[model samples]
Target: MGWFSKDIQTMDDLFVHQLQDIYYAEQQILKALPGMIDKATDPQLKQAFEDHRKQTETHITRLQAVFRMHGAAVKGQDCPAIDGIIEEAEEVAGEVEDKRVLDAALIAAAQAVEHYEMTRYGTLVAWARQLGRPDCAAELEKTLKEEQAADEKLTDIAVSAVNRKAA
Candidate 1:
C-alpha cells in the first residue's frame, strides 16, 4: 500500500506498514549481498559484506519476531526505495572498470543501503514505543544499532583504505 493510502488510518497501521516496508527491504538486501560480495575486490570489504549478509539473516529473523510480537502477519510489502538503491548500485558497479574503484563503489552502495535501513529502524523504534509496544521497539532498536554500526564500518573502510586505493 502507498504511504498515504487509506489503509493506514492510524499510527498502528503506519507502524505495521513501515515494518512491512523494512521487512521487504531486508530481503532485497539479502538477495543482493552475494553479488556485492563477489564484486568487492578488497578482502576486508568482501569479508564485511559476508559478515553483514549473516547479520542480515539474523535481522530478517528478528523482523519476523517483531511482526509476531506485534500480532502482524509475517510478510513483506514492495519497497521501491530499496529496489532503486540496489539498482543504482548495480549500475554504478557495472560501469566501473577498475577493481579498486569497484570496491569503493561497492562500499558507497552498501552505505546507502545501511543509511536507508537505519532511518526505517529508527522510525520503527520510535513508533513502536509511541504505540505502547516497548517490546517491539526494543527489538527494532537492536537492528537500528547494527545498521548504524555497519554504516560506520563502511565509512572506516572508505577512509582507511578503499577510497584511497580508488584515488
Candidate 2:
C-alpha cells in the first residue's frame, strides 16, 4: 500500500506499514550485496560487504520476530526506494572502468543503503515506543545501532583509503 493509503488510519497501522517497507528494503539489500562484494577492489570494502550481508540476515530475522510480537503478517510490501538505490549503484558500477574508482562508488552506494536503513529503523524505534511496544522498539534499536556502525565504518574506509586511492 502507498505510504498515505487510507488503510493506515491508526498509529499502529502506520507502524506496521513502516515495518513492511523496511522488511522489503532489507531483503533487497541482501540480494544486492553479493554483487557489491565481488565488484569491490579494496579488500576492506569487499570484506565489509560480506560482513554486512551476514548481518542483513540477522536483521531480517529480527524483523520477523517483531512482526510476530506486533501481530502483523510476516510479509513485505514493495519498496521502490531501495530498488532505485540498488539500480543506481549497478548503473554507476557499470560505467566506471577503474576498479579503484569503482570501489569508491561501491562504498558510496553502500553508505546510501545504510543511511536509508538507519532512517527507517530510527523511525520504527520511536514509533514502536509511542505505540506502547517497548519490546519492538528495543529490537529495532539493535538494528539501528548496527546500521549506524556500518555507516561509520564506510566513512572510515572511504577517508582512510578508498577515496584517496581512487583519486
Q: Write the per-residue lDDT of candidate 2 for residues 1-167, one digit (tens) a residue.
A: 55476888999999999999999999999999998998898999988899999999999999999999999999997988999999999999999999999999999999999999999999999999999999999999999999999999999999999999999
Which parts of model 2 are misplaced by more than 4 Å? 1-3
Give the per-residue lDDT digits (tens) of candidate 1, residues 1-167: 55466888899999999999999999999999999999998998999999999999999999999999999999998998999999999999999999999999999999999999999999999999999999999999999999999999899999999999999
lDDT of 1 at 127: 98
Q: Which 10 consecutive positions of candidate 1 have the poorest summed lDDT?
A: 1-10
Give the clashing residue pairs of candidate 2, or none.
Answer: none
Cα lDDT, all candidates: 0.95, 0.95
What lDDT would candidate 2 get against the real structure?
0.95
Provide the lDDT at 76 for model 1: 95
